[model samples]
Structures are given as structure tokens and as C-alpha cells.
Target chain A: MKSKIVSKEIHLKKRPAGFVTEDDFELVEVEIPEPKREGEFSVRNIWMSVDPWMRIYMVKGSRIMPPVELNKALSGGCIGQVIESKSDNFKVGECVKANFGWREYWAAHDADSSAKNITKVDPKIAPLEYFLGLLGITGITAYVGLFKIGELREGQDTVFVSSAAGGVGSVACQIAKIKGCHVVGSCGSDEKVRWLLDELKVDYAFNYRKLGESNISSELKRACPDGIDLYFDNVGGKHLEAAIDNMNIFGRIVLCGTTSQYNDNNNTSTTSGNVNDPSTPTLSSGPSNLSLAVSHRLRLQGFIWSDHNDILNEFNASMSKWINEGRIKWKESIFEGLENAPKAFVSLFKGESLGRMLVKLGPYTATSL
Target chain B: MKSKIVSKEIHLKKRPAGFVTEDDFELVEVEIPEPKREGEFSVRNIWMSVDPWMRIYMVKGSRIMPPVELNKALSGGCIGQVIESKSDNFKVGECVKANFGWREYWAAHDADSSAKNITKVDPKIAPLEYFLGLLGITGITAYVGLFKIGELREGQDTVFVSSAAGGVGSVACQIAKIKGCHVVGSCGSDEKVRWLLDELKVDYAFNYRKLGESNISSELKRACPDGIDLYFDNVGGKHLEAAIDNMNIFGRIVLCGTTSQYNDNNNTSTTSGNVNDPSTPTLSSGPSNLSLAVSHRLRLQGFIWSDHNDILNEFNASMSKWINEGRIKWKESIFEGLENAPKAFVSLFKGESLGRMLVKLGPYTATSL
Candidate 1:
């Protein structure tokens, strides 16, 4: 068989100020590098993830992760199949996962090459694509932030999740439900709300956008009549304020993410007219009623999932069982090819994806087949 | 023996709009109620406490406790001597602590009563007045917030306390120092700062008012170059913001009180000319940099010591030993008579008190004396 010699890569054209656009990214073709060293392998990418955290990586010096440099291949989580190998650890047609995404082809040596990261995947447990969403870091994040960091108790606590239809939030919504909590989810669209309420069987689901000019505080109060006990906050700003106001005594606010305040003005929706004014992005300055936290004896903790890798085995065991038993459900908004990878990433901040937004890079190749 | 029939009380004239004042209180005389039923006793008030928490009670519908009703005598923690007893549990001249403050006389039977609450005080352990300040709830609050809620470790963690010379704050600062932490403190006045730095032996102390026009954020950065690990927050607003910004990874903020935000405008010092505009009280709306909490993995928890009565015995044993050994130091800002109680209460908001503020109503009366 003839070896594929070319790879098309997506590059970060410029550092984005607020919302990313098509001009911020570029698609370029180059000859794939040969793995000259011993214990080297070459892989053709299949499934890639476009997560909200990638947006954090784009902002220079804002987070712990090194910023994605300009005019370079943007790296992220991806699933691929070995096309060629010089290492005993990898074989041709073997499926694997790596942090070498936003590209059509990758050439590397060993499991961890500075150029391309690789980890062998077990397809017998679940579909190859499921590893990118449900069985991936996204699901792990949901499990850790909800149960571990949030201190969610089954059958007792009430949970409210913002961006409930998004990747981490959707999984968080179902996990709280499975744990026997009174689950309330806030989504941006009516369709998302319906999916969360009907499909996910969340106890309460509201389209925060449909609430109109009225502030989210009153709507949140009406939505959660019993008051929020554990708030898994993905979207900050008004959602945070509303959560703080409606929290019960000794309520715990798990600061997982702040998707709403990604822009300077705190505007998440791209269709909204306010995007042009980058100078005066009308973001909620902060939670105005933080003083209430004192009287109510609330705890607001912010954490990242990578710091909690010890729970991975437990998460995998429970999540796999839940998936097989049909106790858990997941949805994906898929994009085709490396060309649309930037689009998928941008769509996250715009609330365009109903579930986990991903890009299909190439078809899975199996040695068994 | 002649019975004193008349009792003087300070009544809540009205819920003040923002900051409390002399106009919001009135001195009135009423007949001291006689213990008519068995298990009832009458207490001649000796010492009453004017805490920052009492300010929270004055605010209409702000806390779990019923707001001090307009035109009614405001109640709080107080120490008194038994003048008459119909109960075998108490005897004449026995000193007791109860929630019957702002009045010169109190009569009740049970530990918790609608009119008065009485708990027998062991005066032999320390002075009778010590129960109102150091050996009582104020000291317990500092201990619980510093060690329990804040999870302070002795030499490992760097501690920072706001209102560092106030009742709870001063005790918290000393407790942290005894625990062997490098301590930093923030106070409202130069005298308070000197007291914290020189007398208390805190590693760093700053008069927040002296930082003038400059934000607390920069001053806090300079004060805590190593970064704050445990924060006992009494003053909120800018102090909270500064603490949040200067915190190290996994930092814990014990939200004991928010004396700075007692006024809607967050103006704590009455002597500072910044209080002119009732319209704009110059409060940092909320911590604008709460996102930093997420990056640093911060835990901000608000709590009261009453919820942690389980530790009172331990607190008393440790504190009494510390006091007897002279390892612990304390200061008292005393105002004599029931009439000066309201003025003392207002002085708390004004940051006029260097340490625990108490109003002495009458001389201690122990039969053993």
C-alpha cells in the first residue's frame, strides 16, 4: 500500500480579542514528516474535540496551559489510527488517542512525542467517537466537579447547572439526576431546554434567553422554588448572581467555568448586537450579592479537573456501566473535516452546539476488519 | 434589701437606611419584670456586648434571626448576675451570660426564653467580663473561623486578617500567630495598625485608610508577597477583593463577618469624610476578580461560631490555659452604663474600637466574692 505523504493543518492566524472568527484561523497543507527515530509511529487522525477550554488556551498568559502560538497547528484531544509504526507499542491499523488534534495526519515516535501525543484506545468498550465525549475528559470533568468538588449528595441536595446542554454541563445534569438530586438546568435555546427536560429527564429546565428583559435572579427563584443547594456553575455573570441569591443556607457553588464572561462584555451569544463594542462589553462586574454568602453561610470553590486524576478509574467504571445500562445519555454536534475545526471551537462560545461539539477528521481503520 | 424596680433599655427606634446612628436608638425606662413562675430567675445586667453581628440584626430581614423590631429593645449577648431566683438551677449573686443585652435587667427561667436567655458563667476560670469578650463567643468565633473553617495550619500557611484589631479579628490574628503562621493584618486606623503590628506581633500590618486613593489590591500584594493562604475576613468590599486577588493556590477564605459592607455604600469609618453621599457609598460592587478564585482554586466559606458549639469546651480549655500562661494577649474597649451601649454599637461601624468592644452595665455580683 502507498503511504499518504500529505497533511492539512489548521493554524491560529491571530490571537482573538473577544469572539473568534474565520479570519482568526487558516487551513494549510504540508508534507507529513517522516518518523526517522527508532520506536516511532505515524497516525491518521479520525475524531477530534472542540472544547470550550481550547478558547482559554487561545488567550495568552490567562491560564496555566501554554498559549496556542500564532500560525501554528492548534493542539487538542483527538482519536486516530496507526497508519505506520516503527515502535513495538503501536501497530498499523491500531486505534489510539492523542493531543495532536486540528490536523488530518500526524507523524511521531513513541507514546509521547513532543510533536504528537498518543495513547492506545480500547474500542470494544465503546464506540471510537464516544471516547471523545462521554468517556473522555469532558465526562470526567462533569463527574469530578459535580460529585467530588461540589460535594453533591444523592437524594438530598438540589443542583442547578448553567449551560446545561453543553458538553460538561449536559453530563453534569444527568449525573446529578442519577444521583437522585432535584436537578435544574439553564440552557440558551428552547430546543436545548426541551432536550434537557424531556430527553435528559432533568427535574427543571429553563431557556435563560427566553426569560426576556427580566433579570435571571427572579426567574432562577421561580425555577428553583426549593432553592439551590449545590450550584455547578459553567456560565458565570448573571447566572452566578442568580445562583448566589437563590442558594440555601450552607450552599456550595462549584466554579467549574465562566463561559458567559469569556468576552470582556460577558456576552456569550454571537447573534446579539452587542459584540461590536469590545471596549464596553457589558459583563456583570461581579456577583453583586456576595455579602449574602456570609448570612447564608455559603461556600464558593473554584477548581480544575486535571488536579483530580485519582478519580479517573472510578469515573470510568461508573460511566461505562451507566452507558451500557442506558442509565446515561449523551448528544454531539459534529463538524466534518479539519477545515471546520475552528468553526466548531467558535460555535462553543456562541451557544451553537446542543451537546459536545466535535470534528470528524478521518474514518477509523481497524486491523480486525 | 430594696428591689430595683426600674430598668433602662436601648430600643431600635427605626431601621436606619444604611449606617446606624444615635437617631436610630432611644433610651427608655420600664418596670423590671418579676419572676412569677418556678424555674425562673432575675438577672441584674453587668456587661453587654456590641458586636458587628448586632448590626446585621438591625438590618430589616437580612439574617436568620428575627430583625430587631422597630421601637423594641434590641437584644444580644450579655453577662449578668442573678438578683433573684425561683429556679434551683440558679442562685442569687451567680454570674451568667445570656442573650438579653441593651437592658440593665433581665428575667427568665430557661436557657432559651422569648424575653431572656440565661447560661451560668464559671467566673472562677477567668474574670466575669472575660466571657463577654475573650473567653466567650467572640474568641470562639475567631478560633472556629481560623482553625476550623479556614483550615489554618501553623507554620505552613500564611494568614491574613481584615479588621485585624477588631473583636473577632484581633483574636483571629493572635490565634494564627500562636499557631506559628506568618501573619498579616489590615485595620482601619494607624493606632489599630500599630496595635496589630507591635502589640499583637503580627508579621505585617497596614492601616487600610492610609493606603488612601490607592486600591487595597496593590497594598495587599505588597503586604503578602508570599501570598495569603488563610484569610479571616471581617471587613468585606475592597478587603475581600484584595484578599481574593492576593491568595495562593488552594487558599481558604473564612467569611466570619462583613463589617465594611454594614452600610450599603460600604463606608466603614465614620471619621473618614467619604460618608457624605448616601447616594453612592463607595463600595467595591463585588469582587471584580472572582475569576482569579477559579485559577487559584480558592474556597470562600462564610460561617458563625454558634453553629460550632461543639468546640466551645475545647476553645475554653485552650484559651483559658493560654490566658493563664500569658501566651494570649487581649484588649478591651469599654463604655460604661446601658445608655452608652448604642453609641458603642455605632462605634464598631466607625472602627473606633481597637479590640473587643463591651458596655459595662453594673458591677459583677458573685456570692463567693
Candidate 2:
């Protein structure tokens, strides 16, 4: 049979306000184009990763991470089956993880195929979608950020993670636990607090909602009395200030993402005005109390996981070992169709769902050996 | 023959004003108390070191260094002698360096003498007072703070030293000069500016007075076209803000002292009707642009020379060699009598004098060298 083709894409509809609405995203269908280039390949996207960082990417440019242009299909990591291939490097019908996004069927360009090595996906050790979450960008981000940026030492240290129940924080907490450090995490709700404490095995967890900005510090002090030695920051506003006060001498603050600050389509904003009065001094959330770096001799730094991709195989082996030993565990808040991927990405910023948010595509429905 | 003992001291009498008065100081005489215990020896202060840091130390609750107590003799580092001792560890007339300050004589207590070490003073290379300035705590502070904390590499970098004529900055410029990096120094007067550019061999030197607060940053930029890599801060506050603006990526700001902000002793209360001036917030002269540390990836740090004292011998040798080779030279604004030291200390906060301000003690008559 001639290779079947279809166009599936997640598109932004309207800009969001405070919280993202369903109108913000539109799922579209069109004709799929065939690849004419020698290195090009076509794959039906089976699994699409929905992440908090996707929220930042969705917004055009209000932050360090630039936002996606309006109307562009939001790109993320995807596991897909090769339906057709012009490149001999990828065989037909083999499952592989590609750096293509919220799409049903797509032709990856030569650069995308090279940069994101088209590797076969395995379902035996865990679900194939685990390649997008526990073994994907989130996993590598957690590993490198903890070890390299945070200088996470084993035993007799304190670890504080913001967005503790989220994908990256969950992995960081588990790693800190494995390294024998006291890990305290801050999440959005009581349910996440419960997951962090019971399931994820974080030393301590707190619902950030219950504590007001003024009191968040005292409550954090109660949770991690040992003091924070390594702070893996995903949310970077008042949480950063409290973390600084709680930090021990020579602490390392790793800048992963500021998910708490990004709002839907327009992400990059240098200044924010007070609600009551515009003349009142504006609020900018990302950088807070930098003088803390001087007093306590703290090292605050920002980095991307892609910068340290050299440690990929080691990260995979270690994470797999922990999963088999039951030392690490994670959950996916998965959406049924590829069309819902944009909604899942929006929900990440709105605090609507828990865990590694994702969308499932077709071609992985068959029962595996 | 018995060693003659003349215990001389300079005591704090009254609190200071914009300038320290005779009433602010009291000269006293006391018998040199014999050190009682083993490992304890008497140190007759030979060459007492008075520094810009000493002025900040004279005030209460400075964020940089500890405050000097009222009614007590001021204490800092000095080249001294073990004239008489009961301890087996000590011999008579051994030259040593101690963190023993402005007093003419100090009987070593076990605790105060802990940082004290036996090292012969070398006069031929520089001067006997060089132990109190260039090859002393000040030099070590500049070396470690510039090289280690600041991470100042050789080329493709610029340095801006505030209070460039002060002890630390005076030496730092030469060091940066030696490293083949561009160095700009900020000092008080036209004379000091000439001295800095001519004698210190800094690439650029500007009188901060001529380029006052309003024109601070622009003036600094004119001096350092490449912006700043390493900022050895001695005169903190508004100058600090200018330095921040000129800081390049991954820049390091070492907070050696904030001489400008140490004038709390001189902030005379005005009977301006309402203390709560909601109309205008009272912004101090210190670095108001502290937030710049984030986007610029600047490291603002304060460290005591005592932390890296191990490098003292190494710095001493190099500094001595440099002085002998006529490769480095700096002015010492010596206050003639012990009484003038208080005036000199107060002048630091007022920005009146230039260069390393020192109180010439009776024992430190340089002619003996």
C-alpha cells in the first residue's frame, strides 16, 4: 500500500488571561506532505510531551526562554513510528523518539533528525512514553541541574526544590534522596504535598498555597530545619527570597525554569505594574535579592539541560536502575488525543493538573511483548 | 640588660562627627601586662597599620566588617615584636605580624594572637611600613578578591577599582596592570588622579569628585570602554551603582569596604518635620543598582583577607620583588601623629584624603629603616 498520510497539529487560538481557556488552542487537520530530500523521514507522532517549559515556550518572549511564534505548531519531544523513510538510517515501522511536537503526522527536516538523534523507543523496561518524561529532557534537566549546577553532594546536606511534585522536581527530590540529603519540596496543593511525601519519598513537602508570601519563609524553616544547601528553582519569585534566607553558607541555587512567572502566549515582559496603581513600582519576579549571593557566598546560576547532553547514557542507566529498585516513581497526567496537547501545555502554567503532563498519539496502541 | 617597656595606647573618648575631633580620642599610658600562659607572648606594636577598612570598623553594624567598640583601643594588623615572654615557644625580640591594631603596644592574649605569626620584616624591597600596606592584609585582600573570588583571568577583561588610591585598590591596579588587563581606577582629587595614572600605571584613572554622583556611571564608562570584569570596591554606595552598570557578563564585584556609607556617625539629624518622608524614599549612597547582579551574571561578594592568609607569604615575596624592581609604586597618606589617626579615619568616610591613609605611630618612624 502507498504510505498513508495525515496532517495533525496543535495551534494557538487566542492569548490567555490569568488562566488559559479552551479558546486558546485549536486542533487542525490538513494534507500531509511527502519528503523529497534524501535524509528526510515521515513518522506518525504516537506520544507528545506536554511540559511546564512548553508554557514558557508558548509565550513569545517575556522571559529568559523565548516564546513560540503565534500559529506555529508547539514543538516538543515525540515518540513516533516510522511510516515512511527516504533516509536509510531510520527503518519503517520502528518506534523512535524525535524532537517533533504536538502533531499527528509529520516530516522531520534533516537538522531535526541529526540534532535529536532518532533512537528506537523501548517499551520493555517501562512504557514507551517514559522516553519523553523520565528519560527525556525533564530527566536530563533534573540530573545535570542537580549534579553540575547545584553541586549536589551525597549525605549531610539540605536540598530545597520548588515545584516539588512536578516532573523535574520529582526527579531532583528522588536524586537528592538517593544521595542521602534531606530534601524539602514546595508544591501547589495538598495532593501534591501528599505525593511528594508518600510516593516520591521527599523528606518533607508543603503546599505553597496555604502559606502567604510573608509566612512562606517560617513554614519552610519548619519543614527543612537543617537549612537549604542546594536549591533547584523552577518557580522564582517569593520562593527564591525564602530559599535564600534558609540557605546555608556556600549554597548553590540552580536556575531550571521560572514556570510560576510565565503567562500563556506573551511570556517576555520586563516590567509589571501593580494592579491598584500603574505608577506604583512595577514587579519583576525572576531575579530577587541578589545581594544574598554576597552575604552567604551563594552561587546563583541558570543553565539548559541541552548544554550537558554528554551524560545521556549514564542518566538513562541510573534512572532505570532506580525505577527497577523501586527507589524512584512518577506519574503522567496524560491526555487522550494529540489535539489536547496544547490544552495540557496551558494547564501546566494554570496549575490545573499534576505530574508529567502529556498527550498520547496513535501507533503505540498495539499490545507489546 | 632588661628590655625597657613603654606601653603606649590611643583610646576612644567621645563619638565622632563628620570629622573626628580631639574629644573623640584619648591618649593613655599603661604598664605592659605580661602574658601569663604558654603559647602567649607580648607583641610591642612596631609598625601599626591604619586602613580605610578601619574607618568602617569604627562605626556600628556595618554589613561589611565588624564595628570598633567605644572606649577601647582600635585593633588591626601590625608588624610587632615579642620583647618579653615567659612561654618556651617565644624568644625575645622576634619580629612578627599580628592582627593587633592602632595601639602602640599590645600584650598578646591567646585568642587575639591566634592569627599572629612569626615573619621577619624586609625593608630593602619596599619599606618597613610595606608590611602594613602593600605586603600586608590589604594586598592579600586585593589578590584573593581579584583573582580567586573575582576569577579575573589575564586578557580580554577590564577592571574598575573604586577608591583607587586606597590601600587595596592601589595594589589591585598594579596587579591588574601586571596581568596585562585594562584597569580604570576612581579616586578623589586631580592630584590623586595624576598620581594613579602616572605612578600606579593604571590604564585609566578618574577623580570621582570631578565626576560626581549625577554623572557617576557615564564617567566610569568613559574611563573603562570595555566595561568592567573585576570591580575591587573600596568606596561603596553610588560608585558601586556605576560599577554595576559597567560590569560585563560573569563579572565579579568584590566588596572590600564601603567607605562612603560608613558615615552613619556623621548623619546629623535634621528637624525636617516628618520622619516618614513618603514623598521620597531615603536612598543611601551605596550601590542602588544591586539588581543588576542577575542579568549580568555578576558575583557581589565580601571576604576577609584572613580567609586566604595562606597566600600572604607568596604575595609578600612578589610584592617585595615588584617594589624592588620599581614595577609597582603607591602613595601612603601618612597622618603625622597618633592623634591625627582619628582625623584620618574620619576623613575616609568624608572622601577628603587620597591613597592609603595611615597613622604614623611613635615606634614606626621610617628613618630607622
Candidate 3:
């Protein structure tokens, strides 16, 4: 018998309760089965994203995406090279991006009909990983959120962005600055604050973690003295409450992520186990003065990137020019090995990773058959 | 000297703690003063409105309208006959609408500038008090919040209105039904529920008080099996939370009122006096499921009718046609005398009055010189 190829993969072993740890996942090595049918291909994964949204997927009944099956290989956005193909659409050695993540290799039909999720990438346009960050979902998210949802106007709106040093926030900060709006950003660390203020040229950046024991509301008030006209929220909890309090009349809030609330829930079934005791269930943080939303004539809306796919062409045209002119900048926190992917994801919650965090399965090279 | 005209007025005696009571207001007989300007007119007030928004106005430093001054006549929307006029714009015997409220009689300069707040009424078009309920700010509020803010589409949206028996709510229910939407309404009493279902012909109407201790979410879900697309919120707290939980993707919530939370605060200041304990503050009830707003792409917006004066002419045209066609119907909970005005206002919080609550100062008469 011919020797079989083996692929390393990560699987969800247990559901995370509160904070995620390595124990929640398991690493396994499985035989890389050859394509059993015509029009199939085998791909060697190289780069994968570790995003905050993945935590949302872990919940059993998340409205956004399906949950990660227990004891199954985790699935997410991945970029890889096809090593073998039996289809006319995908030739061997072609690089493509798809939703087959947290694994070393994948084998599936590469027929155009079955490859609805796959897209061919151009490396000469930018580095392969930059496609995952500045040119792909992350960048498009910032564009749609800031300009489309927040209705940010050049010189007219004053914007406040939470998680300012993260992938979407960094791009949002730059976009607002480019639009000539006064931008204020809040991050967990001083270094991230410096990156936003000094590198991104954000009008104001503050370390929300070190707010000197004062309430986030007071800190935000000081930072946005004139009051915020637009708010792009990533870390929900206190950030949302403070935004509601400080928003100007007819302000708009683009709800992106609730990173703080994800791990705080006790379990997949978000309700507190004791039904009689309302206090025990982990209630997500909300604005105590939500009534202000009415008084201030504020608009708070939640949005996901998929709903705005129609803007892709316009986003690409503007972003490509901005990138070529160096008007846009991005940073990455790369974990070298696939084995460290779980750790990379956990660091997001800990506020250790800066910008977009990704796991590199292997080095980039010309596609080889 | 001519005997001075005695005007009985209602004044704020004490700021309400939770539920407004008779103690919060005092009736005072004051000598009516003549308008000092040459263009001023004296009028005998006939009818005035009592609305849910008055609760919001009672809070100190209310951002909506200026707070009613202590020991001074409370001001609100009022209709009266111009007993005297000194200007071309307003003539004696021309019934007009003005903001001089909570008093029996007033003397004012009717110079075009001084009379800017007053508008001559044409009773030949509709009954005079209908202006206060169906044609005035109340009806205009329903028109703006539904079509303008909530963006209600005929046959496309599923709408839920809280306090659906009140002025704005009753109008909103009829408007949504007229627009060809699936309308579900919640009121405090079975009688109000019957009126909404039997009289207004709403698709669903339920007495929220009879929900049998099952959370509002359960009751709402049962009523709106297809999920709610638009929520015209008149009662905040549990209503908001239930609405958030049941809202569909791209749903819109018109944050109109928070009557439920009006009395939850411990005192008039609203701050829990216990400085050492943080939880004691009378925090207005807010949606704990607010994070769902981000997940479902929901838009919760607060709006005031004043912000949308641009729609007045259109509103008058459409609403007049609707009323003339008998496509719109309204009911009034009338307090016979100005002395009963405070009770009328308090009845709103008590859920005692159905439809638009109004204080009838005197019989409608043709303007007389």
C-alpha cells in the first residue's frame, strides 16, 4: 500500500465556560484522504484568522453563525494552496481563500458549483496575509461600519471608536481621519493608544484600562468634550453605555462586536441556571440610561459584514488607491505555528494581541505542483 | 379699578418620587395679568391635554422641554377662544391654539410676533378638541414616529405598539393597520385591549397586565409568531427588553416613551441617596438583551415630534383626508374641569385613562368678542 499523508487539525473538545482556555480544544492528526471523485481538489492551508467573532460561533444557538461542533475540526476563514486538483475551474498550485480553517489540509471538490465559498487571490496586489487583514473582511468591515452605518460625514461628524488598535478599529480610525472628522479612540493598553495617536494620527486615543479609577463615562466625556456624533463600537459592555450617555442628538452607533460579553456568560445556554434568581444569570452589561436613546434622538444599530457585500466593489476601488498612496496602514500579530492558534485567539480576550491576529501554517512561496 | 380676572392654575408642589400623586401638584387662584404689549390678546382657555411626556418633563433638568417652574402655572399644549386681540394675525372671536396651559384664562399681546405661538383654529374642519388628540401634537407624533422614524412599510412590517390605547399609541395602531401591516398592541387593561381589537381592528391586542407573570418576552413571542419588524415603544423597561429579544433582522424600534420606568426611581433626584452603595441608584429599566441589537442588526432610535416639523403640511393633508373618510377614529378620557387636570395627568401613570387624556376647561363656543 502507498504511504498515506497525515494532516494536523484542531478540534473543539469542550465548550468554554466564561474565559476560554487550551483545555477547550484538542489537537489531532488525521489521515489526509485523497479526493474520491472527479472535480475534487486537495489544499494545503497556510494562513488562518483568529477573530473575536469566532467566540460568538462557539455558542450553541448563536444567531450570527452555526456553532463549532463538539469534537469536530473547527471551521473558519482560511487561505491555502491547492496541491491536487481534478477540476477545470481550480488547477493544481492555484492559491485560494475559503472557509476551511484550523486545519493543515482539506480535500474537496473544486468544481465551481461546490466552491461557492472559494475566491482566487492576487499576491502581487499585496502580501497574502495583508489580504486577510487590510484588503479582505477586516478592512471592508471598517469601511461599511464607519461610512455606511455610522453615516460619518467629512468635517461634520465627530467619531469615537472602541478597540481602536484592533484590526477593524485601526482601519476605522484611519478612515475617519482621512474623512477629516475628529476621531477619538479607546484601547486597553498605552502602547495601542500610542499606535493610534502617533501612527494612525487619531485626534485622541486613550488607554481605557488605565482610566485612573474614574468611570469610563467621565473619561469619555473628557476625551469627547463636544460630545460624540458617531460611535463605532467593538467592545460592547461599558463602551456601549458610555457611548449612549455621550452621544449628541441624532447620533448613530454602529454595533460591531460585544467582545467583553462573550466570555462573561456562564455557559452556552446564556440563561442563569437558577431560574428563580434573576441576579445569578450573567446579564450582559447594557446602558442604564437606554431611555436616553429616546431623549437624545439617537440611533443605535447592529450590523454584520455579510449584509453589506454589495459595497465590495466600491470598497476595493477606494481601498486600493488609499493603499497605493500609503494613506492606509495596518499591523499584524502573527503566530508562527498552527498549534498556537488557540493561544492567539485567547490573547484577544486578554488584550495582548494588537491589530489582526493570525496563525501562519507555513511560509508563503510560489504555488508548486 | 375693574375687578381682576381670577385664573385657577396648577403648579408643581413637589417633584414626584416614583408615582405622581395629588401631593406633587397644587391648585392656586392667581390674578390674571394683562399682556403688556400692544399686540397682545386675552383668551379664555377651553381645553388642554395631559400626556405621558409630561412625566418626562417633571424630571429636573429635563432635556425635552423646560421643567415646569415650582409655584408657577404648568405649561403645555392648550386650545382656547381669543376673547380679545390687538393684532391682525389673531382676531377676537377667532378660536386659536397656544401653549398657555393648566390655567383657566390668560391675557397676552397678540402682535404677530408675540402671537407666533398661537394658531387660529377652524372648527368647521374638525371638532376643536380633536386637534389636541388626533390633529395636534399627539396625532402628528404618531404620523412622524411610524412613517418617518420606524419606516413602516405597508404589508411588509410586523409592528408592536405598547400603551396602544393612549393618544399616540391609538393613532399609531390605526395608522399601521391603515398602512396594511400586521399590528399587535399591548395595553394595561382588558377594556383597552378590547377597544384595540374590536374597535381599531388590530390583528392582535393583549392586556399586558394579564400576562400571568410569564415574562413579556413570552407574551410578545406568542402574539408575534413571525417576529416583530418594527416596535413603536411607548413603555420602556420590560417592553424594550421583550422587543429587543423578539426583533427580526433589520428591525427598527421607535423609542417613544418609558412610562414603566418613570416611577421606578427612589426619589425625584433619581440618584440613590446611599452614596456608599452603587446598586441603589434608581437606574431606569433597560434591555439586558441589548447586545442582541448588534447580533440581529436592529436599530433602536429615540425621536421627538418637534424635530420633525418639516412633515406638518404633509401630515395635515393626509390626516385630514383620513379623518374625513372616517378611516381614523379616536376616543378621549375627558376630565370635566381644570381642577381635575392633575388627576388626569396622574391617571396616565395609573393606567386609569384609555385613549387621549384631556382636561376640558369649558364648552366649545364660537369665538366671541
> Per-candidate TM vs. native?
0.89, 0.80, 0.86
- Number of the predicted model whose DockQ against the real structure is largest: 1
Give the C-alpha lDDT of model 1. 0.75
Model 1 stretches astray by more than 4 angstroms: A1-6, A17-19, A28-39, A86-93, A107-118, A258-283, A346-351, B1-6, B13-26, B33-38, B52-56, B111-117, B258-284, B349-351
* Interface RMSD list for the candidates: 2.8, 6.7, 3.2
Give the CAPRI rating of model 3. acceptable
- CAPRI grade, predicted model 1: medium
Per-residue error at B73 for model 3, in Å?
A: 2.9
TM-score of chain B of each: 0.87, 0.79, 0.85
In the order shown, the candidates' DockQ scores are 0.51, 0.21, 0.45
Model 3, A289-332: lDDT tens per residue? 77677668888888877788789889988888889889988877
Which candidate do you rate higher for TM-score, 2 or 3? Answer: 3
Q: Which 10-residue window of candidate 3 chain B scores lowest in summed lDDT? A: B272-281
lDDT of candidate model 2 versus the reference:
0.66
The docking quality of candidate 1, as DockQ, is 0.51
TM (B chain), model 1: 0.87
Q: Write candidate 2's Cα lDDT for A1-369 as tens digits.
A: 564476878777665544555677888776676766887778888888765444445445432446676776767788988777777766667678877777888876555665667677766676788888888777788899898778888997799988777778888899999999999988767877888888878888887667665576897789778778999876656777688767776788876633433322234242121110111122234333344444556666655576677877789899888888888788777887876676666555544566677788885645332
lDDT of 1 at B219: 81
